[model samples]
Target: MSSSAILDAHQTAQALPYLALTQEIEALLQDPTVAVPPRIVQALHGGGSLFVMPAADARVAITKLISFIPTNAQRGLPTIQGDIVVFDVQTGQRIGLLDGPTVTARRTAAVSLLAAQHLAPRRDGPMLIVGAGVQGRAHLEAFHEGLGVQEFWIASRSASSADALVAHARSLGLQAQRVDDPNAALADCPWVVSATPAQEVVLSAPPHSDAFVAAVGAFTPRMVEWSAPVCQHLARTGTLVVDTRDADHEAGDLLQAGIDVAALPTLADVVGQTARWQNAHRPQGGPVFFKSCGWGGWDLAAARCMAQGIAVSSAPQG
Candidate 1:
């Protein structure tokens, strides 16, 4: 019998330098067959946080646990920290253990970029990003390195954080600026990303006519990032693509915004083939929103691709 290979966080980190984890994740997003079942999530009260665990595919199952703690500022540690366990589906054996927070940040940004690649307008334009935390920085890196963004507008409640993000983007050889107002930033950029965990509606007003919005925060029932008006605008004009409609209904952003749950289309509908649901339904103008509630299949696919790459790179030359 052959022994299974085991990988720890260090190995996973080393493998990232050689593998295109971002690109692999993007490919999986385009493939409809990948099975990303509903995620398993739990709320922890002491820290006022929630834990989300998602797993997918038996061939290479990857499980990630994400924590959201708003009060972590009182403590020295970060509010969000977790780990990912990669297993071989056929034999039910563990293969890799990854730094959960790092992978989550990378995968989340990659998924957003994939959505932009498919939904955003053809021409490149200024990009506006709300929130300047880990997700915000990851978005900047991914957009700068992968999306070829020309100019960036970074905004946060904290001006210093926003300025820091802008400077980091410049270090990466990209043109960036800091914005004090969310609405002003939205008005300037055609491509917008909201990565905040604000409980109340942040952008109460509707987006510009040509803007494409990607809402990556607010995964739980209590948290909301986008305002009701924005969701309604999306319903009126473009397609509201989501990882799952069930998850969206539970989100406070959509519920508080009073978005008609019945009107929004599921990822299944967009990826599925049927009458009256052709690809033409994809919005051409106005605000098109793609909300991800997190999927296990995406993680599994990414882990499998990474593992395969590692194996190939380790093989001896002929």
Candidate 2:
């Protein structure tokens, strides 16, 4: 229809342009009353996966379809390629379409940092990041701008990728450097983000007890970014917050660690079922970690925000 809108990658990215947008998304996600339920997630037989997610409330409704192809990176394309379709709640009409990967990259990092706000202590220390890719840069911006990280240390298997990220960070006015020893870097940094797509272990050691680790990659049962020891450490010392309850089944980090995922809590539990999820913690205050395999609710929220931005911008100017 003439009234409908289509948003490209730049416009979609502009929707989540700041930390404040992410803060709103976090609040929405943590609210158990939001009722953004599970969607269809199944692995692809040909080395990828398909995700169909529907997120809605009284005001707006939308669905996102994402396909993950890890090899896309070598093809000079984004690993996540998809689209989000918006629908009018009152009329059930298709209203808008947006670039899915942009919404995802922006929101994923924001969501991870949102968990950090509740699970870890605030500090101005340096932040260490693994995998200097899309998620890595997004996390770096969130930490330096939102979390007040003083410096940044990047580690990656690709020297050029890591160097490029460091330069990008520095250009953003953040103090960034490449590190060879991630273990040592993690020890000094209070905030750590592992954003790689590695199938095997990437972090050899966990940061200190006060450190906040955001395991941002490895969505499949085969791809695990956190090591067994690192996961076990998270299981023993503190509560492991997840993006959704589905992590009980989808998180490779927990499965690799052999941790009983049934005992863990989703970020939604912060609002809905805190008695069991929060009260169980013994207050040892050891290093807390949040593993985000990601979920459709997140995609829905982000896409909705972008759609709203488009609506507001298209309104007749005064």
Candidate 3:
């Protein structure tokens, strides 16, 4: 695989540092040249889903093919597995391939971090992460490296997984612990990330007034992590933002709560008009909730970031 054009998970991650990826995502969100259509989702027989996501900018085009299998966790296999095929927009040539799961995890977390950068009430705090899966760990790392978070609290359905994530955080020289109940921990942790496969409400407690919550667990209309009360409270007293317009229908937490997502702002909207939005929301001094349901544009940012990284690494040293 060393000489292959397709980079493995580790290699793909190496090419996409959180800072670079975050900047790329922010830039692409505002670029009018980029075109990203809604992803194509096909239902699988075994309660799984196959997603075909495609996006293109002036320079390159990419398509990600991945499967989400909830049952894979039982078999000790990854829930997401596939590859992102990058092509040259000019020549229609296949340029490279990247591990899909890595792109999803890192890009999703990076998007959260980008939102937090603009919306979070405070930069450094005890961040509470719900769920101990891949997205959970990615959020922990993203907040730590991207925001200088020094403390963490993790809660999950599986205590062992939660403990493992806590240990990983500890290894990174951060204060971390596993909490039996996530709702109770929400009071002290001003920053919260819920990343579970939300068959049931995992976080119903209301966030603190100045808190920032990124709900990334539930993507479908049926899947949800936050309770109705939590979603409604955030909508009424705080600010509600979505990663993309597709979240209006696909974000389970918001949709199930009957949130008027069309009235909500998006990450692109905020990033495009940062100063005006900051001025408007700063006076309110309410919590910020960001709902993300995945988007093809994010995958496109990852592909562009990887291509730039490859070019930089292969350049001659002066």
Q: Which one is best on TM-score? A: 3
lDDT at 33, model 2: 43
TM-score of each predicted structure versus truth: 0.86, 0.92, 0.96
lDDT by residue (tens digit), candidate 1, 1-318: 034444454565455531266567655645654565566566576746555555655356667776767767447566577777777677777766677666666677776776676667643787888988878887777776667887889888878889999999888788999987888667667788888756566776566676767787777666788877777677777666665565555656776667665455554455453343464365356666777755665566557666776578678999
Candidate 2 — which residues are off by over 4 angstroms?
Answer: 30-37, 271-273, 314-318
> How do these models rank on TM-score, best leading?
3, 2, 1
What is the TM-score of candidate 1? 0.86
- Per-residue lDDT of model 3, residues 155-182, tens digit only: 9999999999999999999999989988
* Total clashing pairs for each candidate: 2, 1, 0
Q: How do these models rank on lDDT, best leading?
A: 3, 2, 1
lDDT of 2 at 93: 78
